[model samples]
Target: MKIYDWFDGPYPARVRIALAEKGLLSRIEFVPVNLWTGEHKKPAFLAINYSGTLPVLELDDGTLIAECTAITQYLDVLDGNPLLTGRTPAEKGIIHMMTKRAEIEFLDAVSTYFHHATPGLGPDVELYQNREWGERMRDKAVRGMHYFNGVLANRPFVAGNEFSMADIAVLGGMIFASLVKLPVPDECEALRAWHARMLERSSVQEWRAMVERGQGVKTLPITADLK
Candidate 1:
């Protein structure tokens, strides 16, 4: 399998971490798409994914899967283990709900603020920006942090006891927030504790190592494990 993505991108980190968790990192090849250069928005890349998003999965048969959730779901079931997604119907429903909520209330909101309010990928990639709307979304993202803090105070994971894609989605939000210098409120102790635990995960450690190794490379095909 080939994954087209930018190294160190928060959204791409989600799927990369999932791949590591599934022990499929050694089997895959990663193709770099430079977000700073606006490669993803270009016509050539847009043909691969209509949404022109990062972290697209391309299979051996040339099947293309876009969107982080879809790719994670596919990978989760590949070994019939479904560890990241969920096995039970109720688990699936709750995980999906919390994941969507994370995206809407946090991750996507931070992305909007980055693209609109901040100089995200520079002037070339950001065709248009809405500063006012972006500021509003920034506020929304902070509110989202507080909301997730409350949720984590009650449960071990975002959805429930088990760590699911919902946790990853929120992790993506936290990653994005950090990149944008949006600090989590000091009062959100539960969220901070949960993030600390997440940072200790082997999958996340692998992802961080990959990011460190990937720095300074431009348009290179980086192996998942760099081995």
Candidate 2:
């Protein structure tokens, strides 16, 4: 299998964390797609993913799986135990709900703010932007932080006692927020604490190391460990 992704990006990092949890990181090839260079928009890459998105998973049989959620679902079940998605019907429903909520309320909002309010990936990639809409989305992302704070205040994880894809969404959003300097609300202590815990994971630490190292346009050969 080959994983089409760019290092240090939130969406790809989400999938990376999931792969680490499943112990599949070393079993696949990592293909670096430079989004900054508009490589994802090129015809060659678009043929693999029409939406021109990163973090695409090509199976050994030549099947393409797109979207973080779908890819997570595929990886979660590979080992018989669905670690991130869920094993039961009730768990699946709750995890999916929280996952979507995190995407729409937090991650997606942060993405909008990055693309519109700020000069995202330069003027080349972002052809048009709406400042007013971006500001609104920023506010919504803050509200999302508050909401997740309240949710975490009652439970250990986003979807209940166990960690799920919902937590990955939160981590991804917070990572993006940090890159754009979006400060978390002071009163959202629970959300802040959850993010700190997430950073302790080996997968996140590996990703942070790569980001801090500033290694650009490098294709990493698969290794046994997260390092």
Candidate 3:
């Protein structure tokens, strides 16, 4: 399988973490898609995914899978007991619900803020932006952190006791949140604690090591304005 990904991007990082967790890191080829250069919007890349998204998975038979959650769903079930996406029907539903929430309330919100409120990928990529809308979505991401914190207060993970894709999605969102300097609410102790624990996971640690080795830069460089 060929995984088209951007090393520095959070969405691809989600799939990378999942692959690591599944112990399938060596099973696929990682193709770097340089988002900073506006390569993703080019015609060749668009042919792979019309949405011009990163971290796409191409199966051996030439089947392409787009979207982070969809790729997670496929990779999670590839082997073993399928712990990431859940094994049972009810578990699946809850996991999917939380995953979507993480995407909408957290990751997507931060992305909107980055692209709209800030210069984002610069004028080359972000053709349109709404500062007001971006600010509103940034607030939503903070609220998401609080909502997840409340949920974590009741359970160990986002979906349940087990570490599921929802947890990974939240972690990915947090990483993005950090990149944009959207600090997690200080009072969200439960969420902060959970994030700490997530950092200790082998998959996360491995990804960190890779980043240190120059496989990717986990977060974008902070400019003077952000600081």
Candidate 4:
């Protein structure tokens, strides 16, 4: 099928990682949506996903999946054993629960501080753009990270030992957190180790090169330590 994939952002990167893990990289076409130029807000893209977000997957028959979680789930179905999302009903439930935890904790926090607290991104979503709300969200995310770090301490991956959709979700957020210079406590060895491992992965390395270059000199690198 024709996957109108957006590989310019963290959301797409997670999908890219999942695709790579399943060995489905060559099965789809990659498309880059310029968020810096406000292309996501443009009419043409909004026509597909009214929510106006990237990492949108479009099927050959014109089917469009908007959210990152949905696209990852769809991609999971393409694998031989369906490991990303889960194999059984209970596993699916846990994976979804943990994935939501990652989003609300790390992902939401970075978005609050980056867009609402920082500038030049344009207030496309006013939900957390204001300073007051942004700061509050910052705290929420920090606490969320701590909780996640503790949860990760005894495990190699999220969702109990095995790498699941939860790992992709959390890794995507950590990359965003690192990009925005979010304070990941040095004491959180698990977080650091996990990020370093992810960075070494071929999928992450490939997508990151594109992200850093595509964002241009203007975006630059917020955290020089990311590499």
- The prediction achieving the highest lDDT against the true structure is 1
Which clashing pairs does model 1 show? none
What's the true lDDT of residue 112 in model 1?
Answer: 98
Show model 2 residue runs off by greater than 4 Å: 213-227
Q: Against the hidden reference, what TM-scores do the models get? A: 0.94, 0.92, 0.93, 0.85
Q: Residue 141's C-alpha lDDT in candidate 2?
A: 95
Question: Model 4 has how many clashing residue pairs?
Answer: 0
lDDT (10s digit) by residue, model 4, range 1-227:
33444445667778777777777766666555566666666666666666767767667676777677898888778655787888889899999999999998888677777777766366654434577777788788788788878888888778887888898888878877776778788788777787778678776676677566653112221121211
Tens-digit lDDT track for model 3 on 81-123? Answer: 7979988999999999999999999999999999999989889
Is candidate 1 or 4 superior in TM-score?
Answer: 1
Better of 2 and 4 by lDDT: 2
Deviation from native of the Cα of residue 100 in model 4, angstroms = 0.6
| Poorest 10 consecutive residues by lDDT, candidate 2 | 218-227
Candidate 3 accuracy as TM-score: 0.93
Model 2, C-alpha of 64: deviation from truth (Å):
0.4
lDDT of 2 by residue, 1-227 (tens): 78888887889878888887787877877777787877777777888888988888889887999999999999999879998998899999999999999999999999999989999888878889999999999999999999999999999899999988999988899988988899999999999898888889886776677667754224654222221
Task: TM-score winner between 1 and 3, please give it.
Answer: 1
lDDT of 1 by residue, 55-147 (tens): 898899889898999999999999889998889999999999999999999999999999999999999999899999999999999999999
Return whichever of 3 and 4 wins on lDDT: 3
